[model samples]
Target: MNRYMWIIVALSISPLSAIALSPEEKGLEIAKEMNRRDDGFGDFTATLEMTLKNKQGEESVRVVRNRTLEVPEDGDKSLIIFENPKVVKGTAFLSFTHKVENDDQWLFLPALKRVKRISSSNKSGSFMGSEFAYEDITSQEVEKYSYRWLRDEDYEGKPAYVVELDPVDPKSGYTRQLVWYDQKEYIPLKVDYYDRKNDLLKTLRYEGYRQYAEKHWRADRMTMINHQTGKETLLNWKEYRFKTGLSDSDFNKNSLKRAR
Candidate 1:
């Protein structure tokens, strides 16, 4: 009789424990989950490969190294190192974000021994030759965009929640974004970007997910395809370590000038 009672208790709690969540609920939950550690401060290392195809059916490849560190209430601090080929080897670019003003960016030239400031408009442009624009490399600020539940669906054989986001800031690079999140894990499966004219500009697909830590799932591989430019960028996470004890001073404007 006690065994039978235990079975009933398990059945009662199962349904309540795995309640199906709404789309917005899933997206927000996953966003919050990814940032749950170190107060959103950590270090990530990845190999970024950019493939640019021209209308003439020619393609060029550029390999890069990407590192990012984020701190709460502060914008994303990042460094992108160019590691391939003889000419651009050891070249590094850094960006320091501001609380109110625009981000300060700089590029260190190995031959020139000088760091040049990056203009705002160029930041929205491509990084190296990849389809992933420079704007996409920085960490996304959740509050800058408002979210709404779109629908529930199945993605890659897993339950998914679809949500749409409208950029609250007028100066945002993109007007709207649609995200698909895994229902079970709360990880983003796919995201769509729409331009200011409300047209689909690019489609980004996330794959090769691996657990970075407890309750934290990181996408190890991402492919970004540019429909307009016929180019693509593939990002492979070589090393993604969390809670590295990175300080704010490591991400200041002075660091940008000394990037390489």
Candidate 2:
């Protein structure tokens, strides 16, 4: 009698444990969960030092300040101001990312004294000659790509889920990206970018992750390596401050020109 009751109990729970989601459904679920975890940080400001290195190992450094406002329904807005390296000082880049539309971006060239709009066609171009593309700097909305759960693997001694994402934009420079997202944090620790030709193009590594606001997980350093060019770019982030009461007016194209 005891064995029969145990079998019935096991049968009841078996159905729940055996439930499985399709690959597409599983991928979308993971992406949505990651996005949810990162949401609710109203705004943030940080200082970044960008280091560009050439094939011959020559290095150039530039300092910039970044401010971003979170927009839950769509995407985030950001303003980036070049602060040092007198040649490019006071130059700013403003971006408004959308959930299902092309992102709006503007570049303020202090030398030319003009704020120029960045067309969608140029979104794949290098950002400030760094390895990072203009689109790469924008907030990555879940709607921008179609995802598939690839597999589970160990990355840097951490258990991670491998996800493949294909960009929805026809003109995107990358054909697809494979990301290793840490299971615990749901944040990507490494990303492999492939060119339009379906050739390996670049690899981006996220490092030095630290939690902010006791909930938000942020990487303090990121490195991008261009495989074809043998060039690299490193970004070091510092002084992250959140919820500074930023508004839409602070992210407009006009604000780019006024950015100090």
Candidate 3:
């Protein structure tokens, strides 16, 4: 064919000749889409019951109240207050998550009547002796990790996209994480956490999801199981109130002392 005719043929088949995206690019696209779908929440509050189980099957329960404020340009701010279990009553934790920087965290201990700052190196430590680390409690920003799309598979009978995440922060306790996101909702259904030694450490599963504000999906129950330690933590969330007019001041370090 003549050059002009060949050009015309190529244009006609452009759809089939589209360039394939690299795995990294595809993964980032998925993460961005997930973040986009979850944007504009403004603020929210919820009540949670945390159950901690030891290797010997002993269980301890604690009641907690949570408040979050969304920041459009940066990351979210959150506060967690412990209400039950007299030993831990009046304890509070405040977190300020950033899109590209290490999160700021503090804890208020009623006994000592002091607010202690949590260092970046200690973020990997367990939260109140639970299976979840301090870093795991912060708002997950897309910029916090690099991603790679692994594959599409079925999880709990739902179609899911499997993606691997490598934390951008070197201080992170986990080396990497594998997440299974619901294809339709763009929400994570399960996550496998790999320890710094690159061993499978824990698995987190989200269940009983309920929609709020007709757009936001909140998991009513989350269970984290530690494979090596044979420990488990279960969080049951309730009374989710969205757009409740939470302010930045409510999540500040000073607010930790006032948290009830």
Candidate 4:
């Protein structure tokens, strides 16, 4: 070949080599930081609230009394106690998900006496009459989703990375989601959710990132707005702790009834 042809080939590959990380890789790096924190879960407390709306403009709100036992990488076991007039407060919700497919979930109710099984099929059901579905709260481990790097842009005057995520589970409620990660803190600043019909469903915004440790950051408030219904849900993290001595026994079935 000619010298000009070789020079052209070298220039074509140089630009691609300059960028070291992709968008999906950046998002995964941020998520790992969130999992491993230094100061959260030393017996922490938080208040969670969720709102739901229908096509007819009816809204329902649910309050959650939350306590989390942090076990880094092993999954954080949290007991969500309902505070509304509904029959959920006294009941307990327990979940333990490992790196593999051994995710165990149980619901203990005073009415049932014994813990009732929650099948994977019913994962899309509403939680305590809130807009957030059960699958939304339980979390999707990194293995459950595939990612694509979109691009880099400025968000809130800071450099940010944008990525698209598609769930591996066909039964998942979301169709797809686009996420933006702050380049400095490596925290998610915004997320765009798509519905089952492949249309934009909602937009979530994050604000007030307080650095807990060298690599830990806590977003004080997160708000989600439904594009179709014009309804909104807000989550304020009252507190978050890390490195608590939570054990495997704490996530067992017998311990669920004692979750209060």
Q: Tens digit of lDDT per residue, candidate 4, span 49-119?
A: 66566666676767666666655565556666666557556777777654435456777886666787666
Please give, for residues 1-260, the per-residue lDDT of candidate 1 as tens digits: 69999998777655234456565664555555544432433665557665566656676767777667765576777778787765888788888764445677878887877778877545457667667775676666566567777888998888987888876656766888888878777768898988878888888999998876454577778888777776666676666676666566666546644654
Best by TM-score: 2
lDDT of 2 by residue, 43-161 (tens): 99999999999999999998999999998798899999998787778989888889878878788988889999877567699887899997788898999889999899999899998
TM-score of 3: 0.89
lDDT of 4 at 203: 88
Cα shift from native, residue 222, model 1 (Å): 1.0
Could you tell which candidate, 3 or 4, scores higher by TM-score?
A: 3
Worst 10 residues of 4 by lDDT: 34-43
Please, what are the lDDT tens digits per residue for candidate 3 over residues 38-100? 899999999999999998999999898999999997989889998888778899988888888
Question: What is the clash count of model 3?
Answer: 0
Q: What is the lDDT of candidate 3?
A: 0.89
* Model 4, CA-based lDDT: 0.67
RMSD of each: 6.5, 5.0, 4.4, 6.3
Cα deviation at 1, candidate 3, in Å, is: 22
Candidate 4: list runs displaced more than 4 Å. 1-45, 51-61, 69-75, 100-102, 213-215
